[model samples]
Target: MSPLALGALYGIVTIIVMCSGMPIAFALGVVATSFMYFFMPASSLDTITQNVYEEIASVTLLSIPLFILKGAAIGRSPAGRDLYSAIHAWLSKVPGGLGIANVFACALFAAMAGSSPATCSAIGSAGIPEMRRRGYSPGFAAGIIAAGGTLGILLPPSITMILYAVASEQSLGRLFLAGVGPGVLLVILFAGYAVYRARKEYRLAHEIYSQGGIKSAYLDDEHFTFAQKVEMLPRVLPFLILLIGVMIALYGGFATPSETAGLGALLAIVLIAVVYRMWRPRDLMPFLNSTIKESCMLLLIIGMSLLYSYVMSYLHISQSAAQWVVALHLSKWLLLAVILLMVIVLGFFLPPVSIILMTAPIILPPLREAGFDLIWFGVVMTVVMEMGLIHPPVGLNLFVIKNIAPDIPLSDVIKGTLPFLLLMFLAIILLCLFPGIVTGLPDLLMGAR
Candidate 1:
């Protein structure tokens, strides 16, 4: 078959298999192996095994597990709760204080956790209940956390950015720096919305109660003494310092990504031990077990995604698709919009890792052809994926919120996320209008990619 025919067939088959509910790794492997066996020569087949091994055995990919472990250790300990408390205490004087605090906490926690579901679980477990107890709408609390959790993959030390770096052969440090600006922008946008919603909702609730209607109480003001705020920071400072240390090490060229991750993981363990005093096997093993299982799953998916990409390339499908895309001669901006939409649709099904590994090669060529900066595109793609995480039917973060706050209906969680979802799109538009928001920090810090 021609490359176009092969590309169409491969996509159709892959989608059908993936939609059949098979594990993504297996589905990719099965489709790749079958396509190679039936459509390509047998002599080249041994390369599949070799490629899978080599693709995953990178020093850079080594950092994924360590970073994941770092997230898991602190995620399983009291770190997230303490961190949220510290931020919450400081934000006590603000309207929609809890909501704003949750967004900020998620951003800080995102740097540590690097996983959306983990960020949601960590912050939501503490923040959601407090919001609920203070009479904030359950939907509002769940939505805030579910939306905030999406930050985990956007901030520095993010696994998604790391995966994008490896796939695009971009600098991990630069990508990390690049993310800082847009990530902060998103945090601001999300928090500003929180403030807006809080004031509106609280005023409405107050008006109802004034008429003897007794509507729900909105925790409009959560006062805290300076001493109380300072006290919470002591517990939160260690993890914040760890995050700062790891980023400086990466950006300053003090260490390789793997080395930095190793140190970060080590420090995370020690902090949990000293601060949370979780030294026992019982305390650490669950984190270890969870990390190992998650790491293995991701590595498997990565290995197979490489194989799938190879199959597309071997079939000349990737090159053909790129050629086809470029041949359209559309404006780069229009082409980029198409690419962004494609990834958003993919995000509805696949996790970020699989999406990056499987699609980056095929899409980057066209993006580069359009003179687009791959690093900037990576941030834009990540933000779009963040939107998918809170979207319906398969939004992982949405389900995470429901799992953590069971009494909050899934419908309510989805509804709550709608506003933040709009904020994410706005973030994307801002990045497009001012590509500098995504690129300026990295270029200033590292002199551009």
Candidate 2:
């Protein structure tokens, strides 16, 4: 059979198995193993064990567990609440300060946790009720954090970025740097919209108060003395320093990704212990359990994914697909739009990790041939993934916020998150118009891939 036919069959069979309610890991594993047994020689079959071992044994991959542990350590502790509280204290004077604080807290936590659901659940649990109490609309309250939760993948130490780095064989450090600019851009846009919406909401409340509404027109009138704000810092400052210091050390070439993740993870544990007083085994078990569970699942997927990719290589499917795409002679920009659209559609069904693992083998080689910078494309891909976490069918953040604010309808959660989703698209546009936004930090500090 032609390589194209083989590739099509592989995809068809895999999709059929997955559609039959088989787990994704099993589907990918079964398909790859079946192909190896049937299409490849018996000698090739013997290497499957070695390949799976070698795939998981990667040094670059060690950071996955460490990062997961660090995120879990903080996510399970009071660190997120502290972080949000301190930020809210500082920003209280601004319109939509509560919402904006949630965005910043999400961005910072995203840097620490590198997982979207964890970020959403941690911050949403604290921020939603607080916003609702302050008279912010339910949809607005839930939407902002749901949108902000996406930062977990766009910010540095993002597991998604790490996975892309491994799949595309790009630098993890460089991809981390690449995400910073776009991540900050999205934060700024989310905050800006929050302020605008807050002002409008305040105006509406004031008009209602003129007719003797139950409450005053003011939106909580929260205030904090500088000294009080400073007081809120002690519980929060160490983690801030840990975040900054980790980036500096990683980008400054002081450590590799694994070492940086290890140091950051250790500091995260210590800070949470000292700050949250979580030294007891009961306190510590939450982060540990989460770390082991998520880490093992990711490693399993990685091993299976590597095997899946190996099958493509063995069949020359990837090579043929790359050549066929190049032969299309399409504009690079158009090709990018098409690829991103495909990613967005996939997001409607599969989670980000699955989308990346399943498509990277096929999508990446073509992008490389089109003269696109794989690192820049990686950032773009992350932003697209962020969009996936907030929408329907598989929008994890939507459900997360809804769970936090059970009184709020899921439709309200979806409607509230829609604006931030658009802001994500705007961020993507900015990156496309000026690709430098994605590459500048990495190119400047890491000397460009």
Predicted candidate 1 versus true structure: per-residue lDDT over 1-449, tens digit per residue: 79999999999999999999999999999999999999989976888889899999999999999999999998999899999999888887777787899999998998898888899999999999998877778898898999889989899789888889999999888889889899889889989998998888888888888888876757344578888888888789989899989988888999999999999999999999999889999999999999999999999999999999988888899999989999999898999999988988998898888899888768999999899998999999999998989997789998898888988889899999999989998989999999999889888987755
- Residue 431 displacement (Å), model 1: 0.7
Query: What does the lDDT read for residue 5 in candidate 1?
Result: 90
Give a tens-digit lDDT track for model 2, residues 252-317: 999999999999999999998888788999989878998999898888888888889889988998
TM-score of 1: 0.98
What's model 2's overall lDDT?
Answer: 0.88
* Colliding residue pairs in candidate 1: none
